[model samples]
Target: MQINLKYFASVREALGGGETVSLPAGVATVGAVRAWLIARGEPWASALSEGRALRMACNQRMCEAEAPVSAGDEVAFFPPVTGG
Candidate 1:
């Protein structure tokens, strides 16, 4: 399936703004999408690694790793935001 991706904050700095991705079979959740990106190596590996403390959204709504994803859905990743 194909989906639009978004990167924000420091994640944007590392992975750039965003891009479209065609996921392989079994990549059905937000976490799976993350794993797929991390599998690509290079900046992706470091940028989306499991160790990173990042936030995710599916279709512009806040979501956890179990969030369902679908074709044409928008998935976003970013460092958590805070205000003082």
Candidate 2:
């Protein structure tokens, strides 16, 4: 399945905004996608690292890593927001 990924804020700066990714036959979840990207090493490994505090959304709805993902779905990753 092909998925559209969107990065925001610092995540975007680190991962180069967004791009399309293809997943081989298997159950692909939000967390799985992240892990896949992190496997790319370097900036991807660090930016989407499990140690990082990042928020996610699927099809415009906030969701956890375990959220189910489907082809053509738009997944977004962004850091938690803070205001003064």
Best by lDDT: 1
* CA lDDT, candidate 2, residue 75: 94
TM-score for each candidate, following the candidate numbering: 0.96, 0.94
Candidate 2 lDDT tens digits, 1-84: 999999999998988889998876664889988888898898889999999999999999999999999999999999999999
Please write out the lDDT profile of model 1 over residues 9-66, one tens digit for every residue: 9899999999998999999999999998999998999998899999999989999999
Name the runs in model 2 displaced over 4 angstroms: none
Q: What value does the lDDT take at residue 39 in candidate 1?
A: 93
* Every model: Cα RMSD to truth: 0.7, 1.0
User: Which parts of model 1 are misplaced by more than 4 Å?
Assistant: none
Model 1, position 46: C-alpha lDDT score: 94
Scanning candidate 1 in windows of ten residues, the lowest lDDT window is: 40-49
CA RMSD (A), model 1: 0.7
In candidate 1, list every pair of residues with a backbone clash: none
- After TM-score superposition, the amount by which residue 73's alpha carbon in candidate 1 deviates from its true location, in angstroms, is 0.2
Measured with C-alpha atoms, the lDDT of residue 69 in candidate 2 is 97
CA lDDT of each candidate? Answer: 0.95, 0.91
